[model samples]
Target: MADVKSKASVLLVGGGSVGAIAALNLETGKQAAVTIVCRSNFNAVSQNGYNIKSCDHGKINNWKPTKVLNAIPKASEGSTFDYIVCVTKNVPDVPPSLSDLIRPAVVPGKTVIVLIQNGLNIEKPLIAAYPQNIVLSGVSLIGANEPSPGHIDQDFPDTLFIGAFANPNLSPQTQKAAAEDFVSRYSAGGKTQCSLDTRVDWTRWRKLVYNSCLNSICAITDLDTGRIRLADDAVAHLVRPAMLEIVAAAKAAGHELPATVVDDMIEMDPLDMYLPPSMLSDTRKGNFIEYENILGEPLREGEKLGVPMPTLRVLYYLCQAIQWKNKELRGLVSIPPKGNYVT
Candidate 1:
């Protein structure tokens, strides 16, 4: 890591609720100049800035970024960012790749790319795309949502576990410094705390304990995580079984995730009963959900390792069906009424 600078030039992509929280974290007394690239609310955010309300940080209205754009600028064609934190959905092979979007901002040894996304093997493409740049993976445990344009509601105690993506070439000490430095910059007194977790693979697989079950299950059953777990027979018949299958797959993949992972997920406070997971939110909005990375990849890996994930396979197929329907709607494909439909 470059001599731990006081001020880091950060480029944050994906201006969703997670992105907004991250931007707020970087901006509140941190010495980083945060620039956001918003895909949907570019005009609103550009004209009026971002407005956020958080249980941790309180109300911060019209908090503007250094710059906002729909895409990376042409002028930044050769510029460099000290850090590029992406708080976007992990839908690889869907939109642009990370390197493609942030090509100009990364300065090999100087830049660190932080991916705060869900699921296993999310960093593979970014690592493959920019083999020289440092890549970090993070999993955030919190409920946040963008209810309206430029308005975000953040739940309390956002704990982000960050770790360096395993690179044989990079020494452990170097990875530690980079990861800890980010923790230092992002961890406010108590708002959205960040920690350096050395176990990247463990974090990813363990988080799947909640994600593989809560995210898809919630979306599938039209219930929140709590509701799904609290229902009379939901946990026994569906949630626990699916999570056990995931744990088996993780073990087969050489990461021994404890069954307590499932327990912890099941025990998550039922107070936030209506908070929808991103997958469910996307489904509700008729937007594409991340099926491959979150579900398919692990299933494929399990199959390769001779472990069958029939439950995950079925749920994955369900999510894929949702994805297909969403893709068609998002692509502006119109379906006529049953009487007028062309056979």
Candidate 2:
């Protein structure tokens, strides 16, 4: 096994909330070199730096980067990175949009691609594309979002679990070393805990179960997590049935998740909790939600495996309808007036 270094040159795709937090955390490691690429073309981030506002860490402003590019430029041509972290949404069709952005920064055999997105379906396509590159699956527990163009808001502090997907050639020693290096960088940098996992299947499914319950409900209702957590029996009546369908789906997928994870999906009162889900935030910002990736795909998988998921199937279709309605409303609101209203 090769000795992993304390620092690594990283190319981070997706400068959304999670990406920003990763960038801030990377700053604590003196040896680490980091660059951020986003669709927003945040050239100002490279100039004035990032301002991260967090409830746990107060205000962190002017967190500069080694480099920041609005888009991955040709100037970065032929440059290979030690690590490539994909923090974008897990829409299977969207990988092509990122292929051009990622191709230049990747160096076969040495670069490790860490996917820190929602859903279990990302592994297959990423592995198929970069067969020679190391592919690792990761789940982020933190909640973050951008309120404006350059500002990041951290809703909660959470841990990161990372492990290999299907690379049998990845030695246990090498995996542990790589995981340790990541944990050290984040822990030393004052970010949340980073842990190595041999069995990430449970971790990934646990998160999926959580999202399957929370994300679509929040999006359809236009409510934050607090509201859902504090919802009364009427809401529970609606939610629990759907959750059970997800459990059935998971079973069909060959993952035996504990029933307790679903039974206790919302354990706290919303009045006491202050967190909002990414899906709800996405709806608010008029951005595309990973609806298909998170809800639709699992439902399809369940059907393929002959699992009954009536509630999930219904919820998925309902969420899609709601999204379409929301989009139509936004379009109507954005239209310019041919003449001023006389009212």
Candidate 3:
């Protein structure tokens, strides 16, 4: 084992499914001392620890990290974190942005901000917030979730692709080193897959092909990926066309995706598998969905480049309406009384 004193101090800011499983692997690496900031799960995790059944790490019971905190400020107190891994959802339209939430713990040049969330253009806000800091763009392809507080289940193996977001303020060497360092620590245990990609935007756009098309479809229709494919003419008429639009947009944005990527993504899951996507899960729970990053941003980008995305445009508005309805249902938004007819 590496010397305890030499372990990098990591403050993980999300304790959801992805966050919880990530904490497990980070702790397992032995290269970082992970302190997970649990918001909703704080009580359960702090009191009972986590019970995880994983295909990657095997079944581990009552697993707790080196440290756990209820809030981000508490983790920041008297501690200078070397890395702040943000595994939270990137709901840009929501209040208390991720940059704002994690600002207190950021040590500027020292603390590397690693974002493991979804959607497009996620790095821009962080880059603007901490211009001097090295921001690593991470794309996680793992299937993990906490069904309940302190209870985790991961059927898919972890495959993480990490790369540094270009910052004019910091040298490429500095950014590259930070990305490499974090990838090394994350993969030190040899139980997970992490790779450094110089063209991470390519990967992001690649993921967009799936998230923008299928994830959105799943959310709006309340169908798992498999059922969506099983639906009458859904793949040929809706799913494939939407994915193709994303590919066209990605190409316009200068990241040419493989021609076969759309089909590969479609065939990734069996037709009968009842796997509800993250967006669908959020919709079921009456939580906000990430329409802005996943759809709005990409749609706007496509529009800017004169790439017509009718299917994606329709999906974006539908998802936005879902978000509005969810907010209204939760009483977070109150609609005004119907206006007097002026006609």
Across 1-343, the per-residue lDDT of candidate 3 in tens digits comes to 2334368889999888888888877888889889999988899999989989999998888888999898786335687788999998889877889989998888776789999989888889998999999999999899887889899999888999999989889999999988888888888888999889899889999998889999999999999998998899988988999999999999999999998999988977666767888899889888799889999999999989999999999999999888888778878699988988986
Clashing residue pairs, backbone N/CA/C < 3 A, model 1: none
Q: How many clashes in each structure?
A: 0, 1, 0
User: Considering only N, C-alpha and C atoms within 3 Å, which residue pairs clash in candidate 2?
Assistant: 41-70
lDDT of 1: 0.78
> Which one wins by lDDT: 2 or 3?
3
RMSD of each: 3.0, 4.5, 2.6
lDDT of each: 0.78, 0.70, 0.88
Better of 1 and 2 by lDDT: 1
Off by over 4 Å in 2: 1-6, 41-44, 73-76, 93-100, 168-177, 229-234, 268-274, 321-343
Candidate 2, residues 88-119, lDDT tens digits: the string is 76544333544445777766667777888887
Top model number, lDDT? 3
TM-score against native, each model: 0.90, 0.83, 0.95
Model 1, 200-245: lDDT tens digits are 7787888787788778888888887667756789889788888888
Better of 2 and 3 by TM-score: 3
Query: Model 1: runs farther than 4 Å from truth?
Result: 1-5, 74-78, 188-190, 230-232, 269-272, 332-343
Q: How many backbone clashes does candidate 3 have?
A: 0
